[model samples]
Target: MHLLRRISTGGIALCAAAVTITACGSENSGGTTSHANGKVVLSIIVPTHTAPPTAPHAISAVRAAATAINAKGGINGKQIEIRTCNENGNPNDAVKCARQAVSDHSVAVVGSYSNSSNQLIAPLVKAGIPLVGFNAITPADYACAVCYTFDAGNTLSFAGMPAALRASGARTVTAVTLDLAAAAANVSAVEQAAKAAGLQTVPPVKVGVTSTDLAPAVQAVIGSKADAAVSVLPTEQTTAFIRAADQAKAPFTFGVVDAQVQSVLSQFRGTQGDHVLAVGAYPPLDATAAYPGLVQYKTELDAQEKTGDKDAATRDSISLRAWLSVHVVAQAAAGITGDITAASLNNGFRTAKDIDLYGIQPKWTPSAKGHVPGFDRVSNARVFFMRINNSKLVPAKPIAGLDLNTGKPF
Candidate 1:
């Protein structure tokens, strides 16, 4: 039997069994096109009610991308229209947004942030709509055949921590995380990766997600004898831990997932903020010359801000990822010679050999079989490192591409 299956749909062949003609409906099926309006509609779903104060910035980035694309003669000459939905940081609401995308005949759901992939994936796949540039918060984001996530998310960053710490001259590392199943899984993955790199890892110290006091976690880190500490906690917890570490005079080098570093740095200044590593999926947004996508993003965002959008000026990993996602959608649609429908977009994505988001992310090519184990759908495991210096984040190292499944540098 062939390891890969060929699925035929609308006279186009797809390479994987995970994608099907029935699931990715025919383009001429009169599904989501606005016949009267002649507009290609896309949807962006985000969590406005949930975590990450940067959620609003993500939404604003989507709007900015859409506006800029429209000004440049939209996808395939049809002016693009973007529909925004708030997932409310809940599974049921994610389902609602997915259904709305289907009902509205959206070509694709681009660059939305939600952890409720269990509820969102099935509906989107059944509707023949792809979730492009999705945040890989759950297993579904990595395993769902129709879902395409460009960046590796925090898991890859955590997996790469051991090597990063070793490079920083640390022989032993300790992890501080919340007492959640996901947190435990992340710590375990990091431990395995660190061990593969020949670095000793201490057992993870768990704390309550809502606990404001991090003195115990700080003390535990100091007592663990680890030379470095990694935090997989949310923004508030990370900030609390940093402050606690400073107060306790913990001497270990510290790092947090790139997404939370901005929040943590915003609360600190000068040398106090220095030395805190922020590991992430993409390069620092400050390196605009290296990543032209950042320049485009800032330009569009500045335009939106001039129009009085409060969140437009907010540039962070969340917003940058969202901006990259929309650009990918436009790039795919622009390559298609025919109508830019859901099926065509899926085909374009599957057949795409090189998807470079103007240096915002590494080159990506989707696969029928996953490039990494567990995250069978993810295509790349490249990580970028940044260090907080004087209240600003600066690049610490060039991008490191890794085979996360093997915990080896790619």
Candidate 2:
């Protein structure tokens, strides 16, 4: 059976995904329609380490996507300059990066993980720097209009995860991940959604990024009378946890929420892979599915003899999330008439709508009340739901209710 997913590729992977241009990307036919405007510089920062060891892949994807935008004449001839800052999982570094990016006059910033990333960048975001994040989202209100933090393509990914658990027919959910406000927030969302669906959201277990034991967490879930357990631990720690759970023959199942689960922490696969699942966003075009616009990216790379064309189309969370971020920033830059500023891009997502770049998800049109214009609170949204299958991401449910166009939740 074919399962849909997304993956992150190195810079080379971006070129490899191009087969031919279609959709908005077709501007490549003649050449990128460069807007006649002054150059704009933007800084994109990502976590140095995390679960699934996805930072490398995510960075590669971002760099490649930037290259694609640049090839298309880059936002009315305004080239986007990407700057990278390694957090090294240290808040001090994160804060330093945030300071440099904000102080540099870049229009936007990307990649903030955990609460520390969010905290590190909060001041910058409040200073009018729009951010697109992959991991920093939590059960709380993280970022706002001046800073649109889109995780797994939308914040709804958090809500939709619990929705998926309900769909799984599971009765109890035991969640574990790194403890912080974000973890609490994630657990709260999942727990509420599960409870509302008549399923129990049990007490969550907290594991540190440096942790290697799962026995305590396992016992906690069992003690909670949970039938299944969910962890938001980093990839390496999660692997150790899963092995411990497996050895103990724990009574409950285990799964994770973030997109980082795909690469190295694919817990449920092969004969021993059952009872593990992860929530996914977009279809992994590289695996199997109809990813129409990417044909050009693929074809482009074929002519160049790139062997890793499929890399760009990786079905990982970081791939789609990072792709959305680049397109959002690129689209924001598209409107520059002359000069570039971080506030300009911040307002771009604020006033932009119907931005269906490559049909990445759905056009995330924000209105004055939120991120962009021409968007209803509910309409113009592309929310996703997916999980691990045979140790790979598979799109199972997508709760994008934006077609209503009313902007009101049903």
Candidate 3:
């Protein structure tokens, strides 16, 4: 009955995905690549096994990428070795991870997740290392010159929410956002986008990160009489709010989940998860489109999972971002005629244009124009929209006002 249902998640599984590889050669901590045991080395810094366990499976994602590459003769005949660092969600630890990347002489830091991008980007930037496809979280990340983001991060997601809701036939929207300053900023962005989309907005119902009882918040959404409501919340709070909304049967559609929450949308089942939209940098793992990247990722990740690596079994947005990041580096490295060292990789990424990821994401350029004011380094401003149906996420049509390239809605 809706454009949302026009596509189904079922698609033909592709045999193999193509990848780019480079002849890596030896070299330094100061913008050069150093290998251990004659292997091309890259590192991923993630907060795994932390207090809140942020992207614990990201390490496996990197590992799986390496495995897939190695299976095909290992990035131009030399096996790729991935070194992982657990930042533990601490700023100091994040800095340590960056410093470690510098000391270990990693060619690039790919697909890292950190709340401390301000701290993490410093050492890598000084060492002339590029951050590829990292989870763009903070203002520092969006503004970092050396950080290459496939996703425009939370701000763009918020900016795109209004158009997505409006496209879903919603004229009035209410916000359910966390009380933190970042969430408030996102809500503000949503308000602006809503105005541009000609959608009416209600003052957000703010919930604390620690707020467990979301029934009252759902009541507030019900009182707003909005046709749709969006959230800017952490994973735990999002789950709680959705559950509360489902229990109370709120009259508005809920949606616009971030990568972190969208990764695990399957955890929400039946009516509780239906009709919600999600925005992400990459296509969903069960994307309706027959993306070669998705097939390759599933194949590689499943291989790792078969080996009894429990972490590999945990496929979320963090890991998928990591997987895509490594592939980006590898694909870029393939074009290098000389040494595939840190300097070469960094230079390649900086000068890259129209790099395609086989339908996994939008074609990205490191130096794309029309940058958003605060998020100057967000090269790929396009956001993919997905909807939950039958307790799963599937690709949905591009909603009006959602494309950042359509105009600077952010």
For model 3, state the Cα shift of residue 286 in Å. 1.2
lDDT of 2 by residue, 224-266 (tens): 8888776666666777777677667776766565454566535
lDDT (tens digit, per residue) of candidate 1 on 181-234:
856556765565556566688888889978999999988888889888888788
> C-alpha displacement of 62 in model 2, angstroms?
2.1
Error of 2 at 398 (Å): 12
Better of 1 and 3 by lDDT: 1
Instruction: Tell me the lDDT of model 3 at 405.
Output: 50
Give each model a TM-score. Answer: 0.85, 0.69, 0.85
User: Which regions in candidate 3 have their CA more than 4 angstroms from the true location?
Assistant: 1-30, 179-183, 370-379, 397-402, 407-410
Give the Å error, residue 62, model 1. 1.3
Q: lDDT per model, in order?
A: 0.70, 0.52, 0.69
Question: What is the alpha-carbon lDDT for the whole of candidate 2?
Answer: 0.52
271 Cα displacement, candidate 1 (Å): 2.7
| Number of the top-ranking candidate, with lDDT as the measure | 1
Full candidate order by lDDT, most accurate first: 1, 3, 2
Estimate candidate 3's alpha-carbon lDDT, on a 0 to 1 scale.
0.69
